[model samples]
Target: MLPKSILEHTLVLDIETVSAAASYAELSPTMQKLWALKAEALQRRLAEEEKMTAADYYPEKAGIYAEFGKIVCITVGVFTKNEEGQYKLRLKSFYGDDEKVLLQDFSAMLSKYFQRRGQQYVCGHNIKEFDMPYICRRMIVQGLPLPAPLQIYGKKPWELHHFLDSMTLWKFGDYKAYTSLKLLCGLFGIPTPKDDIDGSQVGRSYWEDGDLDRIEVYCKKDVFATAQVLLRFMLEDPLALIFESADG
Candidate 1:
């Protein structure tokens, strides 16, 4: 595997999201409308799931998967080598309150990082198909500008000068089936996060109690897991893409 020094320019990111919802029956007309739309989307998604599990591919269903919900928050944790050869992660979170402002802040941070280092990459679990696109879409939704590095699509996956998705790397060959972050963590023997809270529960926590701290903690744990998986890739030398390759 490549030495840790070679990966000094990589950043690990993870995010949390919550959709618009109302807890009690009495709600404003605007919220009622948003809730209705979200509910309809959820029902269609459930139907699609049943059909998809039966070997049916539905384009509309895939679209639902893509556009079901909007991002509520994004937490990015950047890891790099210190002078002492130890990895340190610095973290920041963008709460989706005033999404435009948050996205602008995020873009500014990316710009600052790139200018400071000249080159850096994003490394995350399932980032290519999910997290990266979600961030881009959220930015677009807010009508905020995106930095050039964030627009890394349409290039050869291996030719990407920056950005690496751990799930993509793990799927170096076989990618026919879905593999989750939790599953890969188990394979690498990385301790998974405590299950007291999960992605599904975050939305409830956010809408019901306005719990940003819990969501931040959950996001950090995901970032930590993502970092651990990347460490295993760079240091453990267990996977074929690493141990068996000349690059190692």
Candidate 2:
């Protein structure tokens, strides 16, 4: 179980990403060539399991690769104690069509607020393998400085106290099996966040539907679910609650 102090210091987060371009045809000539190379490599691995061409898979799979995608939304949540000693999560999202602007805003929030609290942690589901690295790579591509919590280059495994992953925690050193956050939430009786839109549909929602607002709401739900999952791991009662903005 996580210590109470650590729970207070943790920042729960979730991100929504999509291919940098709406369609492969919209990419620059140089980027199109690069994607072709990436697609070739992926096709080799997936040849036996599926019979789809690179172009067919690009829209669905490209967003998972940081080099080929951009983050459209980032939702961050913090746990706060009320006078009654109950914990409530407050969430904020930074999102827009401009990837650079949103990334800059997220970085600024981390540097100015969370970084000031020494040894503060950022927690998420499958973040170590996906979200954290994706954010770091995109920041580098956009010429943004790496946030303090994300600068894990030279640190040993034992020294990585500032990064927490729900999937890794569940693994408990057994790395053979993979689990999804939705499955875990169901197991723990927490509401699944995928009821509206799963990760697979994010790219289409952004590019075709042009509904960033829908994407933002979905991202926030993910953040809430992730936080509740962490609470369960910490042996605390997971609250199946959603907080809305004052304007909403």
Candidate 3:
């Protein structure tokens, strides 16, 4: 049982990722030849050098691994209350395969949804910082045109007329410099899903197992969490949602 304002719009979001690519050395032909000639020498030198730390290990030709560059999976989930006044989960769209097709489909789907529901809002957890920026970069890379509705770079931080960040709302006032969706879900007594997959396993899943479905499910769970946060923010939270008293 929520007011109309809270159930007025839907939230759409997605994520992209790339798996372990060649290390910096493997990319350079000169370094490749060096490795070929002096494997032991290089290993010993690397072992001694601070740069050779375990953190520097990179999978060999892992496959187009880019930091905040390519998108691996795009999961879009929508939240709306049906006639019965019960919140429902609608996976509006889930696209993950070729990066180009995914982005195009994502943009098209968003455009269509916005066109039909002109005034609805779109939201996600940390979308402003990660998902949106990553998607934009991929679009630019593929030279695919971004639909008018998906053009979000021009909007101001607090002036997201059509987009909202669930994380932002949850971390009001003393908003921490870091807040993971999982962490916030825990604080709010929401059950965060536990799966064997994470961003780190994405590349392996994509290449070895070709299990985009798992990734899609993972992304959907995130969207569900985001929707839950929005629900709590706009209705369940007494501090945020002001309800009329029975006496009134």
Give the winner by TM-score: 2
The count of backbone overlaps in candidate 3 is 4
Itemize residue pairs with steric clashes in candidate 3. 16-71, 16-72, 17-71, 17-72
Candidate 2 per-residue lDDT, tens place, 191-234, comes to 89999999999999999999999999999889889888888887
Per-residue error (Å), model 1, residue 161: 4.9
Candidates arranged by lDDT, highest first: 2, 1, 3
Residue 34's lDDT within candidate 1 is 50
Off by over 4 Å in 2: 47-49, 116-118, 240-248
Question: Cα lDDT of model 1 overall?
Answer: 0.63
How many collisions per candidate? 0, 0, 4
Among all windows of 10 consecutive residues in model 2, the one with the lowest summed lDDT is 239-248
Candidate lDDT scores, in order, read 0.63, 0.86, 0.59
Q: Each candidate's TM vs. the true structure?
A: 0.73, 0.93, 0.72
Leading candidate by lDDT: 2
Candidate 1 clashing pairs, residues 3+ apart or interchain: none
Per residue, candidate 1 scores C-alpha lDDT tens digits across 72-183 of 5667766654666566666667765455676787788788775432267788887777877878887777677778777655767665646678877787678797778889
In candidate 3, residue 204 scores what lDDT?
Answer: 65
Q: Higher TM-score: candidate 2 or 3? A: 2
CA RMSD, predictions in order: 8.1, 1.9, 8.8
